[model samples]
Target: MKKKKGDKTMKNLKKKLMYSIAVSTLLLGTTIGVFASWSGQINVQPPGWGGSVVSWSGVTKTSNSSKFAISGIKESNSLDPYAQLVNSNAAAKSSWCAIRQGQTTSVNDNTGVANYIYYTRCKTNNLEPNSNIISYSFNPY
Candidate 1:
């Protein structure tokens, strides 16, 4: 029994339509899967295995006669870190060195008190270790 030409053409068209639908579905699924796994935060860790500053509570100032206290948190403390204080009027620097990580520590005023105090968060350069400051504020108090 010979099949009619119109019936054969219709079957071919249906097969092509089914193939197109399957390919389209596969591509759409792939695109959606790729977008679903994205994370919003950038990695700022300094070539190490730890995360960047989780939170900063800001600098606090306290004064008692000639002595002053400046304190804050450096949550991801990986190296030699300090809370540094500078008096702009008197040209003096007071640094509280080797503070325990994630703890509130005070940098005392070794020199006489000045009109303004500049607080800085700094760490020793991992490569040089004792050479220079890794991070500090340009402005002083």
Candidate 2:
């Protein structure tokens, strides 16, 4: 018996459908595999709102130096480190307390742009015994 023309057409249609499904599956698998192993680097610019906290240390009457490190900071016009000796006394109503002896090698104290570690050394006069906090803050201008 000879095969009919309609039967051959039906067989060809089935083969085409199967081939299309296989190709689609292979393409999807390849796309997923390529995306699964993706590795990339991200660079963050300096933020506009917040400042960097370089250092924090407790202050005492004795001489001590507080060191803070700087990292990942790019060049900017107003990037500098600031050091302050704070007297956190609850009883003392006066906002202004006795000044203590201190020195800072901050970028603000320098002539040009500086990047790296910053230090602040303070020798307490011990006049305001309640004041015992040294704060170092970094701000962009």
Candidate 3:
């Protein structure tokens, strides 16, 4: 077959396009992986005078390796705060307690996959009426 004048140019252009696309895809994947994170807050108020309250927040992260920090404030000192990281099946993967005011409590799960996190506040030794407003923020990476 006789070689056409534009055939070589067209072949070169096609190769360049494919290479550009491959490089773009690799860069996009790396960017997303490096800057992926999720954060939220939860508030719980117990109805009774001496019971516990629990609230849950969910995330879309799919990695088995995860780290999270939870911090919160309580209206009363009698209420103790707790945080937990759970998997997609609602199983407890890791848990932390004694979340103090103005401080953060963190948990790192390298082997257990997590999809949800929850916070709890339990009233202890306080016979007074329950008028506690507990709020917690969850940050996961």
What lDDT score belongs to each candidate, Candidate 1 first? 0.40, 0.31, 0.57
lDDT-best of 1 and 2: 1
Query: By TM-score, who's the top model here?
Result: 3
Model 1 lDDT, residue 24, Cα = 100
RMSD list, candidates in order? 19.2, 20.7, 5.7
RMSD of 2: 20.7
- Models 1 onward score TM values of 0.33, 0.28, 0.49
- Clashes per prediction? 1, 1, 0
TM-score of 2: 0.28
* Model 1 root mean square deviation, Cα atoms: 19.2
lDDT-based ranking, best first? 3, 1, 2
> In lDDT terms, which candidate is top?
3
Question: Which residue pairs does candidate 2 place in steric collision?
Answer: 87-131
Q: Once superposed on the true structure, which residue ranges of model 3 sit more than 4 Å away at CA?
A: 1-36, 46-51, 73-75, 110-131
**Model 2, range 67-135, lDDT digits (tens) per residue?**
221122222223232233222321211121211123222232222112222222222232322223332
Point out where model 2 deviates above 4 Å. Answer: 39-141
Model 1, 1-141: lDDT tens digits are 999999999999999999999999999987764443221212122332221121122222222333333233332434544434444332345644443433434444445333333333344334422332123222121
Off by over 4 Å in 1: 1-72, 89-91, 112-115, 125-141
On lDDT, who's better, 1 or 3?
3
Ranking by TM-score: 3, 1, 2
Instruction: State the lDDT of candidate 3 residue by residue for 41-87, as single tens digits.
Output: 56666554555544555554545566656676544545554556555
